[model samples]
Target: EAGVAQSPRYKIIEKRQSVAFWCNPISGHATLYWYQQILGQGPKLLIQFQNNGVVDDSQLPKDRFSAERLKGVDSTLKIQPAKLEDSAVYLCASSTRQTEQYFGPGTRLTVT
Candidate 1:
């Protein structure tokens, strides 16, 4: 199977600016997730999708963070008016009910 794909592995922006990250998960996976990982900390789930519907987005900061998976294949995460504390690795991962989860390299965002 092909691996997870992500782009712009690194990004730098000033506080209150905006940024977005993209992800294309492996073929045939039924579950997708977007997570924020702080330095030296475990990844925290931001949003989760089962097919094209949102299964969970309890941790997502609705005021500034938003995401979508229109075709259930590729997804995008956007943060408007980004904050300095938003600096972290944004990871995209996928899994099937019968398989283990796989992660992408992640987009590391830095806010000044």
Candidate 2:
């Protein structure tokens, strides 16, 4: 099976700038998620979507981060006015039911 795909493998931006990342989950998956993995830390769930409906976004910084899964297949995550702390690896994952998730090669963001 094809794995998840993400674009812009890496990015560098100044603090307060905005950036967007894209993801295409494995076909047929119904659940998608966005996570932030900082250096030396495990990935933290930022948002979740179940067939285009948001399931969870409690950990997402609403002030600067927004995400959407359109038509239940593709997803986009955007961060505006990014802070230095926002520099991290942004991961996209998908799963069926409650089973294991398949992760994409994450987008590494560097904020200077």
Candidate 3:
């Protein structure tokens, strides 16, 4: 089976700028997730979507970060007024209920 796909594998921008990342999940997967992984830290769940509806987003920094899963397949994560601390890899994953998740390569952001 194919894996998740993310575009613009790397990005560099000044703090306070805006950046967006895109993701496409594996076919027929119902649950999708977005995660932020800072260097030396484990990945943190930023959001989870089930069939285009948000299942969880308690960890997301709403003031500057936003995400959406459209039609339960493709997803996008955005950061406005990006911060230096926000420099991290943005990962996307998908899974069936009660199954292990498969993650994408991730988008690495470097805040200058």
Backbone clash count for every predicted candidate, in the order shown: 0, 0, 0
The global Cα lDDT (0 to 1) of model 3 is 0.94
Q: How far does residue 74 in candidate 1 sit from its true spot (Å)? A: 0.1
TM-score of each: 0.96, 0.98, 0.97
How does residue 62 of candidate 1 score in lDDT? Answer: 99
Instruction: List the candidates ranked by lDDT, beginning with the highest.
Output: 2, 1, 3
For model 1, what is the C-alpha lDDT against the true structure?
0.95
Write model 1 residue lDDT over 9-84, tens digit each, in one string: 9999999999999999999998999999999999999999998999999999999999999889999999998999
Top lDDT prediction, candidate number: 2
Candidate number that wins on TM-score, 2 or 3: 2
lDDT (Cα, tens digit) per residue for candidate 3, span 1-112 = 8899999899999999999999999999999999999999999999999999999999999999999887778999999999999999999999987478999999999999
Mark the regions of model 3 whose C-alpha exceeds 4 Å error after superposition: none
Q: After superposition, how far is residue 14 of candidate 3 from its true place, in Å?
A: 0.6
* Best-performing candidate as measured by TM-score: 2
